[model samples]
Target: MISQEQNEFLTQVGPGTPLGLLLRRYWFPVAAASDLNNTYTKKVRLLGEDLVLYRDKSGHLGLVQERCPHRGVSMVHGIPEQDGLRCQYHGWCFNSSGQCTEQPNEPEHSTFKDRIKIAAYKVQEMGGLIFGYMGPEPAPLLPRFDGFVVDNAIRVIGQAVLPVNWLQIMENSMDPVHTEWLHGHYHEYITTQNGSKQEVAFQRKHLKIEFDRFQYGIVKRRLLHGQTEDSDDWKVGHPVVFPYMLAVGSGGLGTYAFQMRVPIDDHHTWHVWYNAYVPGPDVEIPDNLKEVCVYEVPYKDQNGAFITDYIDGQDIMCWITQGAVADRTNEKLGTTDKGIILFRQMLKEQIAKVAKGEEPINVFRDPAANQFIELPLERKKHHFSEGFASITQRFQTKYCPVAQDLIALFERVGVH
Candidate 1:
C-alpha cells in the first residue's frame, strides 16, 4: 500500500506533479472520430487540463488550450477555417500549432497576432479514436498493438464517465479474483429466453509478469463449464501497461477489447475503448453477444456488478456515490488485491523514474497490428434454475467453499 505521502503525490496530477509529468509523456485518448461532426470544435477536460479538440478546414486535427488567447473566451465556439480555428468572440484564428494566424478585428495590430498564442499539443488518429500528447515538444510516437486491425473483425467504440479516481478504476481491471465471485459465483446470468439463469465458473490462469522498459502484467481468466452444452470457455487476458492503458482478450479471433483510463480530474475519469474483432468467413460470430454500452453514474457502484455490467452501468453508479473526492483512507483491501499492489508498485517506480529525468516504459506509439482467428459457434439454449443451482452447489463443493459463504454474506448484507 502507498503511504499518505505517496498518495498525495500520485493524486496531484495537475500541471507540475510527478505523476502528471509522467502521464503527459504518453499519448491519451481524447475522443472518438465520430464525435467530431461538422462542428469542428469540442471542449474537453483531460489530465486536469481543460482543452479544445478541433479540425481545421485543411482537415488536420488539433488539441489546444480551451480558451482563446484574446479576451479569454472559450474556443469551443470557434469556427474552422483554412488550417486553424477562429474564435467566435473576436475572430482570432489559431492554427493547429497554436499559433495566431489571423486577427480580423485588428489589421494594424500585427504585434497582437505575433504576441498571442495558446498552448497546443500533438495529436494523432488510430482505430477510430483521436489521441493527444500533452507533454513537451518531441513527444514519442503513439505505440501500436499487434492484434487490433485484423480483417472481418467488428470494431466497436464506447466510453463512460466514472466518478471515482482514475487509479481506482484502472486498478480494478487488473484484479482477476473479482470475476469468479462478482461475475460468476453469485450473480444470475440474464438469458434471452424465458428469463432463465445459468451458473458460471471462472477459469483463471497463473498470474504472470513481463518486464521490458515498462512492465506488462497479465491475468488470463475465462468462463468455464457453464450451462450451455456447446459453450466454449471465454478466455480473456488483461495486459496492463504502465501509466493507464489496458488491453484485454485472449488474442482470439472473435474476442478483443481495450480500455484507456483518461483522468478528467483527480476524482473523475473517462473510460474509452474498442471491442470485438470481425472474423473471417469461416468464423461464426455470436448474435447474442453485446459489444458496447455507454452510460453515466457515480463511481462506487462499480463493485456491485460484474466486470461486463460494471463497464456498462455499475461503474457510473459507483463514481457518483463518492461525491467527487473518494476517501481512500477508509478503503479496506485484502489478499484479493494482489494485482492492485503490483500495479501500484509499477506505477510508483515509473513515477520515480520520471522525477529523475528517466524514460518511463510501455508507451505504445504506433498503429496496432491486427490478428485473425476463427469464431466459435453461438449457443442458444438456456439453463433452468435447477441446473444453475446444481452447478452452484457443485462449484461450492469442488472449488471454493467461499462461494457458499459469499452467498450467505450477500443475503446477510441484504444484497437481494
Candidate 2:
C-alpha cells in the first residue's frame, strides 16, 4: 500500500516530482507521426509541462519550452525555417537542439544568441508515433518492441484524450476484471446486440495472466480471480512496466493494446496508443481500423457510464466520476482487484527505486526481445454463433497458417 505521502507525490506530475521523475525515465508518445507533418509548431502538454513540438526544415523534430526566451511569448506562433523554428513575433530562430541560432532583430548581439535558448527534450520517431523524453539530456535510447519491428506487418496508430488522472488511466489497463463486467455484463453501448442487452459471464479458470519482463527475460505467473459457484470474482494479472506503460490483452478479441498515459496535468491525460494486428496478405485492411476515441468522465458522477460507448466516452465517464484523486481510502477492492493491487505495488516499488536513483524494471532497450500476443482462447467458448464462427474461420484460414511459424518463433523467444 502507498503511504499518504507517497500518494501525494504520485498525484503531482510537475517537473522534479517523484511521479514526474519516475515517468521521465521512459520515452513517452507525445504526438502522432501524422500530426507532425510539415508543421512549424504544435503545442503539447506532457507530464504537466506545456511545450511546443516543431520540426525544422532540415527534417528534425524537437520538443521545446512553450515560451520564447526573449519576450516569453508562446512559441506556437513560430514558423518553420531551414534549420529551425523561427518565432513569428520577432523572427528569433531556434534549432532542433533548442539553441537560439538567429536573432534577426538583435543583429550584432552575438551574446543573445549564445546565451538565450529554450529548454528542450530528446525526441524520436518509432512505430508511427513521435516520442519525447522530458527529463534529462543523453536520455536512454527509446525502447524498441521486437514484435513490432517485423518486416511484413502493417502498422496502425490511434489516440484518445481522456478526462482523468494519468494514474487512473494507466491503472485501468491492469484491471482485467473490468472486461468481464464493463465489457461483458454491463448494458453499455458496445454490448447491445442490435439494441438488445445480453447477460455475459466469464469462465475464469481458463484465464491466464503472464507478465513478460523484457529486460529480466522472465514471464512471471499471475494469479487471477477464478469463476466460482456463488459470485463472480473477476481478477487478472497485468504486466505494469516501470514508469507509465501498461501492456494488456483482451480475452475475447485476441487483441493486445499498448497504452501510454501522457499527463496533460494532474486532472487530465492524453491516452496515446498503437492498436496493431498481423493481418494476412489475403485480407484487406479497413480504412477506419485505426479510429480514435475520446472519453470525458466527470469528477462527481459515480454511476456515470458504461464501457460500451465509444471507448473514449466510456473511459471518460468511468474515470472522471472517480474525481481527480480517486479516493481509494473510501473504496473496497477485493479478489477482482488483484491486477490493480499488483499494479499499485509495482508502481510504489518503482517510485522507491526512482527515489534512490536506481533503474526501474522494463525501461531498457533490448533488440533481441520477442513479440507479445494476446491469446483470445479464454473467451472463445462464449462466442458461439454462425457469424462469429465465420469470422474466426476467416482469420484462421487467412492468417494463422502463414503466421504459425512466426508465432512459434516468438513463442520460442519467450513471448506469450
TM-score of each: 0.73, 0.74
**Model 2, poorest ten-residue lDDT window?**
376-385
The clash tally of candidate 1 reads 30
- lDDT score at residue 346, model 2, on the 0-100 scale: 68
Error of 1 at 348 (Å): 1.0
lDDT per model vs. reference: 0.60, 0.59
Candidate 1 residue-wise lDDT, 250-322, digit = tens = 3322335567788888878887655544344444434432222222222233465423222234334444565
- Positional deviation of residue 228's Cα in model 2 after best superposition, in angstroms: 14
- Output the worst ten-in-a-row residue range by lDDT, candidate 1: 376-385
Model 1, position 386: C-alpha lDDT score: 26
